[model samples]
Target: MEAALSLPATLVAKLIEDAERHGMSVDEYCRAILSESRAGDRSSAQAAVINEPSLDDLKLEQLSVERLSLTAVGRTFESGALSGHINRLLPLKIGCRVLWSLLSDEGVGPTIREFREEMWSRVGSLRDYLRMIDEDYARPRGDRLHASFPNSSDAAIKRFLNQYIIRKSGLNAEQSSGAMIDFGLIGISDTGRVQFTEVGRNFSLLSNPVLDEEDHRGPSLSADEQVLILSQIRTEMMREWKFMRHVLDGIHVGSNTPTSLLARINRRYGPGTKADWSASVMPHMRSGVLGRMQALGLVKRTFIENRVEYRVTPLALVILEADVV
Candidate 1:
């Protein structure tokens, strides 16, 4: 009966996110929440959804069809599938830079407390923003961890912390951004400071470059930095990510285009496997799977007549030949 209801997409996304957070399948999560709601207090049960919109609300501009661009967020219903909240948004070089910032100070870069307060603090005050701004402005312009906030107001800075940071890096709620941690690069120390693991230390050496506003390229990866960046695609992307090998296989088998590769993955996924999120996988593959591979020289990407295609690199072919799978 519940399956018949399309339900609010937002709620559906939240359900999957909560399920992933608890290391449960969507069905398992729903059952657990329902059992809890039935057995204990109804208010706190994770299953209890409130304030559904009415038909009139559906007609509102916010929920209108014209704003349907956000329907592609990855929804992981299966446990431990290719569904982690890695930085699907940022390119690998910027990610390296982010890691470098955390590895800057000796034994203490950005503390988890500071990250949590910046990313998700309800007690955020103007004084806090001003203090942070003063601290940041104290440093050289491009040398600040966060892009300097001298010109932006408190509210603007807060919004940037939530929206821009969330979109660019991802809400850490853990290590400033769960992206680095998921990629097996960074972790939190006993002192609650954001620190690099053995892998991240290697990544930091090259990522720390002189990036300044004089170079509007703050958001873009510069050529010199790209040359400086280490090749973690074969190591981390393929080693850590379960989805990369399959994407490599797809490219090798002539499923080179994004659309074709996506179709192949959805078609090949099985019931017992951990990858049942095919319904919401495109967003993850763009940069997360394909882009990283291309950036790290594992694949070649080209656009022809509005269609982008990828071809496996010689290095990637070597990995494919060596792979037993």
Candidate 2:
């Protein structure tokens, strides 16, 4: 049996917050609370716990199930999307958070025009971002700025990657989306919106303005933090990439080129791939797989016995042997 009682806006908001905190639905939370109540009321011992006050100044209006304000949604969305912790990882595109929020909802996500307006509001023009990038590159570093140690120069590079967008060519939405798809971070939903892969969602959120700035900027995060970011990146890469580990392993076990590496892989799998190497499948293994790994300091291309060969980097070896805690 059940009954309905319209809750005050304040109480409903609190209930929603508490439900989310405990990973419970509103009905479940309310049922639990009722179950805990002795005869529908707290005992004398529990009476000390403050009861909900009827404060006129609190804007305690009746709950409206039909419509909730955008500010309310924004508050909930930004609580996770724009939080400081997430803002330090990847330099997210301006509307990335908005895109994510919309995706989290049921219906269709925001249209391209709506997304572009948000971008324009946040960043006036393309040159504005370029100028910010210029500023970032110009910031004085290590010994030069007398900020800290020398060899580790101040460099934080994340060029505002758009998760999914449709804008002018200057935004490079298509190219950015292509790179993300190649990296296996996102996929196209049936509704034509970007959807985060499992590891992609777990990676970490990032704000546009100060994103990746923590890698350098005014106050750098601790070494543990820095390594954590890299570790997460590596984990996500491994989760999505099919050929990276294989290619790296082949290199470690003395396979120079794709033909040689493919031969090695064929030993584990059936035969055929070595003889039937196609660009569509392998797709520039050296530049595509190994090169992306190189960006993460995972592998290096060097001349071995007068032949260009890929070698696993020290960072990759360290991660393989022992991941940093």
Candidate 3:
């Protein structure tokens, strides 16, 4: 039998708009809205159903549902019915006490000790419980693993869930409609509260860009190409002049070349050599250093014998020559 509800026209229009934005059908949108509204009630029912089960059994069920849903989602972990259903249920079922505490006035953001106590109070060892979940979810079904860990930790999972709620509910003015940036599910605010942002919520429909395998080598960028590519880098650094000074100061004091600069960064930050350093530590440095140097007419790169090499321009020497003590 088909179910029907008496919804206001305005609400129906908004739901239709949201469904279109997410590439879901109007029926799917209605289902999602209904599901979200009933999440707490449904969770209560689920809790009642498993109240008598041992903690091990409950944990096993949690792990099983997570694995099955991950499999159903095709290992890519798209935000849909299965993922949403799991998100709504898991925390309430597995970490009900902790969730209750968080809801309570006495619960300041849970510390590691508090978290451990809450987690282990229900189950045996927290690590073993987590390992069980991980082992089952990560086991290979066909070509890919059951569940993917795009971000680390349970806190991250919660953050993702919270973000999903905000996005689905349209809590913010900016999220009226259309695509937005993917800031991951978790965010650490300036005040150090681990919370979800509208940015994270909007990312539910977006694709995860990071590749899984380590050995999958991709294309390389050329010097001119890299320069053009780094326009965003230039704008970012210009926004913070102190960052530019900090980077230039490092290069000026050291005798190492650009290639060796990456090694120096890797010693402090670990792995991926130049690519890692460029993306991580020196994102501002790439175009910041080069653009500033070019503006001051200090450095120039030329292709010689099919190899790109950089040298200090005469104008750059004039400035640095005066600064040299």
Top candidate on lDDT is 1
Off by over 4 Å in 3: 1-258, 264-284
Expressed as tens digits, the lDDT of each residue in 244-272 for candidate 1 is 67778888989988778877767656333
Query: Which lDDT tens digits does candidate 3 get at residues 1-325?
Result: 8888689999989988999998999999878879987997899899976653223433222222211111000011222111212211112223322222332232223322344344434433332433443454452221121121114466644453332222222433232211111112323233322222322222221211111111112111122322321232233223223333333444555523556554443453334532234345443344334444433334555556755445665544454444432
- The residue pairs found clashing in candidate 1 are none
**Predicted candidate 2: what Cα RMSD to the true structure?**
23.9
RMSD from true fold, candidate 3:
24.4
lDDT per prediction? 0.47, 0.41, 0.35
TM-score of 2: 0.36
Local accuracy of candidate 2 as per-residue lDDT tens digits, 18-93? 9999999999999998888864565644553443221111111321212211110110111111111122222222
| Total backbone collisions for each predicted model | 0, 2, 0
Candidates, ranked, TM-score: 1, 2, 3
Position 207, candidate 2: lDDT: 20
Candidate 3 structure, TM-score to reference: 0.20
TM-score for each predicted model, relative to the true structure: 0.47, 0.36, 0.20
Ranking by lDDT: 1, 2, 3
What is the alpha-carbon lDDT of model 2 when measured against the actual structure?
0.41
Worst 10 residues of 3 by lDDT: 67-76
